[model samples]
Target chain A: MIEVENLTKTYGSYNALKGINFRVEKGEILGFLGPNGAGKTTTMRILTCFFPATSGKATVAGYDVFENSLEVKKRIGYLPENVPLYKDMEITDYLTFVGRIKGVSAKDIKTKVSKVMGDCGITHMAGKLIGELSKGYRQRVGLAQALINDPEVLILDEPTIGLDPKQIIEIRQLIKNLAGRHTVILSTHILPEVSMTCQRVVIINEGRVIAVDTPHNLTNQIQKAARIFFKIEGPAVNVVKELNKVKGVKMIEKKETSNGVTDYIVELEKGNENRKVLPELIIKNGWGLHEMRSVEMSLEDIFIKLVTEEKGVKT
Target chain B: MRNFYLIFKKELKSYFYSPIAYAVMTIFLIITGYFFYNIFATFSTLSFQAQMNPTLAKQYNLLNISESVVRPLFGNVSVIMLLLMPLLTMRLFSEEKRSGTIELLLTYPVRDIEVVLGKFAACLAIFSIMLVFTLLYPFLIKIYGQPELGPIITGYIGLFFMGAAFIAFGIFASTLTENQVVAAVLSFGVLLFFWMAGYSISFVSSSLVSVLSYIALTQHLESFAKGVIDSGDIIYYLNFTMLCIFLSLRALESKKWRG
Candidate 1:
């Protein structure tokens, strides 16, 4: 539903999007994950035809964003980072205004506005002015605004920002519900937001595309340094030495020793399990294996490592 | 055209949604009405003094409706509009930019010209509404005096177009900045400059005289105020309004280029 090619946007000497390329298929929700100032909003703006790309091309719903911007604009619903709304307008009035501009037929505007308002669960606040609603309600109204015309593509930038955790989950669910009908491309710096809500993600940083893959695969790839927390009743030095003897055990660092019990953090080599070997080795040495728990590789870790690491992956 | 209408309706509704439209209308009407009553009061006081003194009766008797009432009313309203139109038009684009709604607007499927026209049309409508209230003065005159409707009609047409011309400039000024105050001041300064330039027609040499008169907006209004209904004056306003509207459109388009 969206294609961006060599999408370079330069502001004088600085590049906001440096020849970045990505695509989203029909009915797929592609999470655009990056840290702040990472060109995610710039990419979304270009796709929505806010401005033409400086040196490249972008297409949405099969029309070039620059050449057929009006058509492209008609097919995509954009929720900007600020979720710009008229504070003075009542919800129904604002939605009606947006509906007409989005090209909903005159007779159908009422029904369409109500439908999106219902979908976003803002039916109760239809009579309130937008300024009177809370952040969460206003955010829902913003979502409803984007969904009013039922466009084929939704370009949402930081949709859940500034909302409470429950509101976040509600918005996530709302977006998840949008997937098999509208192709969704949303930008966020939150990793869990991507893992929980998106089918695929394009990770960008510092104006360049770093990685693009399924959330599952991206997390799995960075789980190579699987870590474990170990507690054994033994001398701390001896526990370290014994764990080193087991193949696939990469490193062990002593954490603490309370009385005779020692706490150690162990790193396991990729694709290998010394988990089975550790219990047998402890029994032979007669040291009690008090507690052993493998640490789950979290998407947070993957995101931090992926963003902090300096390796630039090509396409 | 439908897009223009939709945008125009929203803009027009928005003006009333806040204190802008009402505040501007009230202030404009109060100030212009003061001048209207003041002009007629002077005319009546002169007539009264002339009847009592008999020495000044000839001069006061010549205080006709066209000279003492219609001409000064239009001139006063013109100056009043020059000041008040900026207050109404300043927020047209500046408020959108400050609130960040311009992004949503530009991303909509409407063309740049449509947005410009929509905003200009709405501001013009509000100005016309304000002018409509001032017509009560003429209505009262029609009841009490035998005033020529031709000059009254033509004078109002001139007033409407000139106010509209100011509105076009105001919209262009709005496109220049995000602060409504700055936009208002900038538009006010520009209009004031044109007023000063027109007033300077008396002080300059003959060679520079024609140039200043042409540059002066009031020179274009005099014929319309006298019921001449010159097409040249009509075309001047049309060209001025269109030129400013076109420039404002270019200013909006420049953002894409500047980006």
Candidate 2:
């Protein structure tokens, strides 16, 4: 539903977006993951036709963002960062105004506005002025305004930035529910929001797309050595020495505890099954293994490693 | 057209709901009303002989009000408009740009011209309402005395065009800055220069005076105040208004491309 090719935006001396290239298939929820000032908002604004790119081409729903901006604009719904709203207007009134601007029929505006209000769960506050709403409610109202025209593509920038935990979960669930119907391209610094709501993730940093893959694949790609953690009720020195003696154990780190319990983290080379061998080795050594678990790498770890590591993949 | 109407309606509704519109209207009425009542009382104290024999009137009527008092008072109406119209229009695009709502507006299916025209129409409508309220001054003069209805009508026509020109200039100024105060002050300064330039023309030679007078908006308004519907003066005001609006549109487009 969206195609961007060598998209670059420069503001005087600074390049906000550096030749970004990506595509989103119809009905795919693509999460734009990046740290702050990672060109996420710039890319979103370019795609939505709010601004033109300095160099490069982008099209949405088969319409060029520059040449056919009106068509692209009609097809995409954008919720900008901070959810700019007229504070003096009521929630319903604001939605109606947005609907009218989006070219919704007068008769249909009422139904569509109410439907979006229900979808975002802000129906109860329809009569409340936007200034009087809580941050969570205001974000929901912004979402409702974006969704009122039932756009084909939804471009949301930090949709849940200021919301509380429960509100975040609610918004994540709401975005997830939009998966198959709306082609969503959301940019956020929150990694879990992407993992929960998006099927594919595009990791951008310093104005470049660093990695694009499924969250699981991203995690697996970064995870080289399989590590396992153990809390054993035994002598710490003996446990570390025996773990090092295990055939496939490449590295081990032991922790000293006053309770006579030893904690060790053991790393085994890839393609090695540490779980199947760990119990037999513990039995042979007469060491009591109180608890054992594989320490799998999470998306957070991969994200931090990818963003922090300087000389890695250029793509 | 439909999009323009929609934007226009929303903008107009915003004016009614916001305190700026009401505050400007109230302040405009109070100040203009005071000046109007004071001028009328002063006019009432004078007799027709005061105009024929100024030397005799200088003895009895210590305050010598001129036949020019009516025109200058009406001209002061333009000054009042210059101050208030900027306040009315300062939020036209500046507020939207500052709040990031301009992004939402631009991403809509509407063309850029629609947004500009919609905002222009809304500001003009509010200005028309304020002008309508000022009509009470003309009507009071008509009821209390037999003031020439022709010049009064033409004077109002001059005020209308002057207000339109100021509104367009104000909108253009508002487009330049996000802060309403800066927008208002800039527009006021621009309008004041044009207003005072007409009077300052006397200090220069007649040849250069005509050039400066042409640049002065009030000089064009003088023909309208004389009950003469000169197409040249009308076109001048229309062209000035259009130039400001065109500049405003260009500024908005530049913002989208450069900012």
Candidate 3:
């Protein structure tokens, strides 16, 4: 539903997006993960035709964002990071106005708005002024507005930034339910949000795509060759040698023994699940293995690792 | 056209929902009302004295409605329009930008001209509403004396063109910044420049004086207020207002790149 190629955007001397490429297939929920100032909003703005890219091409809903911006806009729903809304308007009125501009037919606006309002859990605040609504309700209203015309693609920037934990879960659940129905591309720094709702994650940093894979596959990759910290009761000098001899071991760093139990942090090559052989190896070397536990690398740590690497970003 | 229509409707509603429209309207009516009463008082006194002293009325053209009331009233009213038009148009694009709704508005399938024209039409609609209140003066004058239909109609036509020209410039000013006050001040400065352009003719060379008088916003209306509907005045006002609107479209288009 969306394709971006060499999308470069520069504001004067500072480059916001540096020739990055990514795509979101039809009915796929792609999580765009990046730290602040990672050009996430810049990318979304280009797709929505809010602004033009300096050099490159982008298409949404099979229409070129630059050449056929109107057609692309008609098929895509955009919820900006700030959720730009008219403060004085009532929720229903605001949604109606959005519907009108979104090109929703008059005969369908009432039914479509009411349905989206219900889906976003904002039906109760239909009569309330948007300015009077709390932040969470305002977010839901923003989501409802983006759901106008049953858009084929929904681009949400930081959709749940200000929501409380419970509201976050509710929004995540709603987004999760939309996976098969709409192609969603949401950019957020929250890792768990991607794990919770996004089917495929594209991690961007410094205006480049550093990682792209399924969350499950990423976690599997992290688990398969995770570093293991070992506290063994043995002489420190020989322990490093024996540990490095293990067929799958990539590197081993040893520290002085505390209470005579030598510590070793080992990073094994990827797909090395031969942790079962570690205890046997220590026994064969006459070393008493006091502790043998693999260090758990969470999704956040993986993201930080990929982003900090200067080149050879995993994708 | 449909895009323009929707945006125009929303903007029109926005004017009524906010206090700015009412505030400008009330002040406009009060200012116009003061002048209306002043003109009516002068008209009544002049005619009353004319009835009493026929020789005095014959000696002076003071008893004529076109000179005593019609000319001065529109001349002053156009000044009021120039001053107040910024208030109506300053928020047209600036508020949308300040509130960050400009992104939403521009990203919609609507074209740039639609947004510009929609806002221009909305401001024109609001100014027209305020201008309508001044019509009561003409109606009242008709009740007492025989107000010449030609000059009365042409005076209003002049006010419309002047108000429209000011509105176009005001909308252009609004597009230049997100600060409503800055927009208003910028509009005030531009309109004031045109208002004084004709006055600068005496100080400048003769070659430039003709150009200055031609560009002066109030100068073209002089023919209309005098009951002379010259094609020059029509073309000047039409082209000037259209140029301002065109400039506004260009400004809006540039935002897509500059942003």
Candidate 4:
């Protein structure tokens, strides 16, 4: 569990974290979604006790990060941005070293190292030097280092960055598996990564937290109106007039017309079953219905809209 | 203590894993060995001259092998250490900071002092090994002639402490920057300034002369090299080493304050 209350970090004239607040429940995987220079790494660094916050408090597992940093550090595993690692060390050796510093018992270090290597899918590269590995493997090695101690809390900054698409999927799966066992707070600029892996998301921008909610709720809260994409082979002018006459049909914008088919995006009022009404309306009009699908706003759209300050709802 | 040991082991292992340690040790040995040979050659020539002439023997006082050869050998080794210890310690913290490994290292449960001491111990260990290799010079001298054991032992103690102080300063320098070359050059300059500080005593006011001499790193080594183990000199080197280590610890802790 982690609690950050009004945590502010300032560097000279610039503020990296402007009194941001968030809480992550035990075994909950919280995604810290923000664009570049948005204080994600700075927040993670303060939580990891790499540095103390300029103001306010952050507690991990009931220990204050500033007052009881050693205890917090003992219970938390951090994978810093850039995945810093001793490049000359072998994979197993590096993991074992981290395990030792993380306070794993000497007798259990071997098992822990092997287990994490397996968990991160770097088992075959155990004997290879970290410097010799490719970027993806190096990223895995960094993850393995963080998991070596099996700490109660895991703080990962941009964990999937620089990995190939396949590696990224594998890592996301690995992190998703960690839910309900280890409390995870991973930061990323990638929007869908939050929707796919995190139970809740915290969207931050310009040193301030803009919104925090479940990925699904964020989309629903930001949409305001339902949008449906429809293709119909009908007279465009007459179809628009008839659709406007239907109750709860707010607007219909003609997207494009080609090959005698017109693509229309219909904005329907909330709680309206315009989807059920549209097909009958087209049939009565003697028009062939080509395609009809509701268009849900993806997390990507919500992210951009929130970050760009078009719409936001704090939870 | 356990944290210190773990960090120390990792640091020492890293040194051996990289080429810099081997390169520094070999270069240190080769250069020191050359100096040792030259000093010994000059001593041998002087002794041979003394043997051929009684007046020269009385004038040169060639019977004190410790003074003529062992003491100067230690002096040369100390100078060699002054040059090489920077190379050994430049990467201790600078490379970690440069490669961004310091982030993970600092976040570990280990205390800040433990990291500084652990790194200090590792560099001291490597310097000790280099010192051990130089024992061959004394061993050869012992085989060919009789050297006083007192000065040999005392000189080593002096070299050990002096080299350790050099390493501690180098570690502090390493902490000040993320650039290895900058760390190395900065430490070398600081050490050379202190080593040359004693020479400026005559140029300073009488009241400031003692201060300059006391702070000069080389002045403390002479007492040990001369077979006189003054507690004052011992305390000076110990305090110097501790001050540098403390400075390094503070530099490391500054991250929490300023970051």
Candidate 5:
């Protein structure tokens, strides 16, 4: 539904998007995960035809964003960051305005507005002014407006930034429900948001696409070395040194110490089966073996690892 | 045109939703009403004297109610519009830019011209409503005295076009900044410069004086105020309005690249 190739945007020597490339298929929820200033918003702006890329091409819904912007725009709905809204307008009024401008027919505008309001769970706030709504409700109104046209492609920049925990879960579930119907490209700095709501994740940093894969696959790809957390009742330095002497042990780092039981993360070499040896070694050394468990790599870990790894490679 | 009307309706509704429109209208009506009363008082006193002394009436041109009262009323209203138009148009684009609503607006399927014209038409509509309220002046003149139809009609035409030109320039100024006050001040400065453009004619050479006079906003309204409907003045105001609207469109278009 969206294709961006060599899309570069520069603001007078400051490159906002440095020739990034990505493609989103129809009816797939693609989570654009990135840190601040990662060019995610810039890329989405280009795709939505908010602004042209400094160089290269972008097409949305099979129409070039530059050459056929109107056609592209008609098929795409955009919710910008901060959820810009007409604060003075009523909820229904704002949604109707968006629907009309998005080319929803007059006869259908009322139904479409009501449908989106129901979809976004903002039906009860129909007659209230937008300025009177809370932050979460305002965000819902923003989402409601984006869905007013029933657009084929939805570009949302951080759809759940300021919401509380429950609202975040609600929004995530709402977005998850949108899968297989509208092609969504939502950007967020929140790591777990991608794992929870997106089918595939594209991690970008510093105007570059560093990794793109399913959340499960990303964790697997970056989990080359098995990590085990060993809590032993002994001196931390001696336990780490003794663990380092074992075969296939890549590294061991002390985590924390409390009541003479120390927590340590031991990295094993790929294909190493020394999971049994570590506990035995602790038992044989006269130190008490408190607990032994393998730590599964999460999307957050992979995200930090990959971002730091990219910075390490650059330096 | 459909998209333009959609935007126009929304913009016009938003104007009434905010207090700026009411405040500007009230202020405009109050100031213009004061000027009208002052002009009417002078006209009434002059006519009372003219009834007593016919020679003085001829010398003062008090014989024509339209000349003594209606013409000055239109002129005063035009000046007042110059001051209030900036307030009316300052937030047209500036508010959207500041609030970041311009992003969603531009991303919609509407063309650039549609957005520009929609906003321009909204401000023009508000200015027209304000002008309509001032029509009470002409109606009052017709009630108490005989007022010439030509100057009253032509004077209104002049105010309409002149106010439109002012609005276009105001929109252009609004697009240049996200700050509403800055937009208002910038447009007010531009309008004031053009309002006083003809004043420097006497200091310059005769050849340059005619060019300055042609460019002056006040000079074009002179023909209409005198009940003279010259195509040249109408065309000048139209051309000025078109140029400012075109410039506003270009400025809005440049925002895409400049972003």
Candidate 6:
């Protein structure tokens, strides 16, 4: 639904986006993850035709963003980071106005506005002024405005910023519901939001895309060594020494318990599976292995590692 | 055309809902009415045959009837508009920039000209409504005494063109800054220069002085106010308005590239 190639934006000597490239398939929810000022907003703005890229090509719904911006704009609904709204306008009136400007027929604007207001759960406040709304309600109103046009592509930048936890969950659920109907490109600093709501994640840092893949794949790719945890009732010092003797076991750390139990974290070489021999080995050593579990790296760990690693190499 | 209509309607509604438009209009009416009444009272005391003070006596003589009172009624219209136009337009683009709504607006499928024209038309519509109310002065003159209808209509045409020119300049100034106060001050400064340009040109006798007078917006307006429909004067105001709107469009378009 969206394709960006060699997209770059420069402000004098400062390069806000440098040759960033990414694409989103139809009906796919793609999350753009980055820290503050990581060019996420810039990339989204360029894609939405709000700004022209200094040197790049971007197309949305088969329309070039710069060359055929009107077509691109007609097909995409954009919710900027700050949720800009006319404070004096009522929620319903604003949505209707947006629908009209987006080329919805005059006959359909009323129905479309109401449908979006219901979808975003702002029907109750439809008659109230936008400026009088709370942050969460304002964000919902912003979302409703974007959805009023029934756009084929939705570009939302930090859709849930400044909302409370409950509001965040509600908005995340709303975004998830929008999948399969609207191709979504969501940019946010919140990692968990991307992990939970987006099927594909693109990590950008310092004006460049550092990683792009499924959240699960990113974690698996970054986890170089296999680690396992074991709770054993045995001689603590001997258990640590015995675990080190197992083949493919590169390192082991054991913690002694008050009840003569010991816990150990065993690290194995990459591509090695030691669980098959663990039972036999524990029996042979006369150590009672009460609990055993594999430790898998999470998306958070991978994200931190990737961002920090990129930072380290830069310096 | 539909997109322009949508934007125009929304912009017009916004003016009525917000206190900015009402406040500006109220203050404008109060100031204009005060000055009109004061000028009329001072002239009423002078003899109808007094020709020494030609401008003041002529103004009084023109105010005798309702429909022909446009001369004195619109004499102070420019000054009233000078204060109100900036207030009405200060938030046109500045508020959008400050609140980040400009991004949302640009993302729609409307052309930049459509947006500019929509906003310009909305402000012009409101200014026209205010002008309609000032018609009461001309009507009052026609009721009380006889006055020339030709000059009255010409005076109103001049007022409309001047207001259009001022509105365009105000919008251009608004686009240059994100702060409404700064936009208002800058618009005021620009309008002040244009209003004073004709008088200032008198001090200069160089060949450039005549060219500058042609460029001055008030000089063109002065001809219309005196019952003249000069094509050159009409083209001057139209060109000035178009120039400002074109510059504003460029400013808005540059934002996308700078992003």
lDDT of each residue in A1-315, candidate 1, tens digit only:
788899999887888988999889999999998878889998988898888899888888889999999999999899999888999999999999899999999999989988888888889888999989888888889889889999999989999988999879888998999999999999987877888999999988889888899988997787776688878997777778878988999988888688899888889898887688888888789998888898866656766788667564333
Rank candidates by DockQ, best first: 5, 1, 4, 2, 6, 3
**Predictions in order: lDDT:** 0.88, 0.84, 0.86, 0.90, 0.89, 0.85
Name every residue pair that clashes in candidate 4: none
The sequence of per-residue lDDT tens digits that candidate 6 reaches over residues A191-240 is 67877999999998889999999977776788888889889888877777
Tens-place lDDT per residue, model 2, B1-259, is 9999988988998998788889999999998988888887767665555668778577643332323445666767877887788888899988998897887888889987888889989888888898899888877776766566777788788888888888889889988988888998999999889877878776999898988888898777777776788888888889889999999989988987774
Which lDDT tens digits does candidate 6 get at residues B1-259?
8888888998999999998778877787788777767765554455354466677566644444422234556667887798789999989999999988888898899999999999999999989988887777667556755667887788888889888998999999988889999999999998888777777776787886987788776677767767888888878889889999999999887776553
Q: Tens-digit lDDT track for model 4 on A1-315? A: 899999999998899999999999999999998878989999999999999999999999999999999999999888988988999998887888889988999999989888888889988877899999998898899888888888899999999999999999999999999999999999987768888999999988888899999987887789878999989998899999999999999889999899889999999988885678889999999998999999877656776777656344432
Candidate 4: where is the Cα deviation over 4 Å?
A228-296, A307-315
lDDT of 4 at A271: 85
Which pairs clash in model 5? none
Candidate 5 residue lDDT tens string, B139-205: 9889999888988889899899999899999999999999999999999998999999999998999
The residue-level lDDT of candidate 5 at A42 comes to 87
DockQ of each: 0.72, 0.67, 0.49, 0.71, 0.74, 0.62
Give the higher-lDDT candidate: 2 or 5: 5
Candidate 4 chain B lowest-lDDT run of ten? B56-65
Candidate 5 off by > 4 Å: A228-250, A256-263, A268-301, A307-315, B51-60
lDDT by residue for model 5 over A246-268, one digit each (tens)? Answer: 99999888887899998888899
Candidate numbers, best TM-score first, in rank order = 5, 1, 4, 2, 3, 6
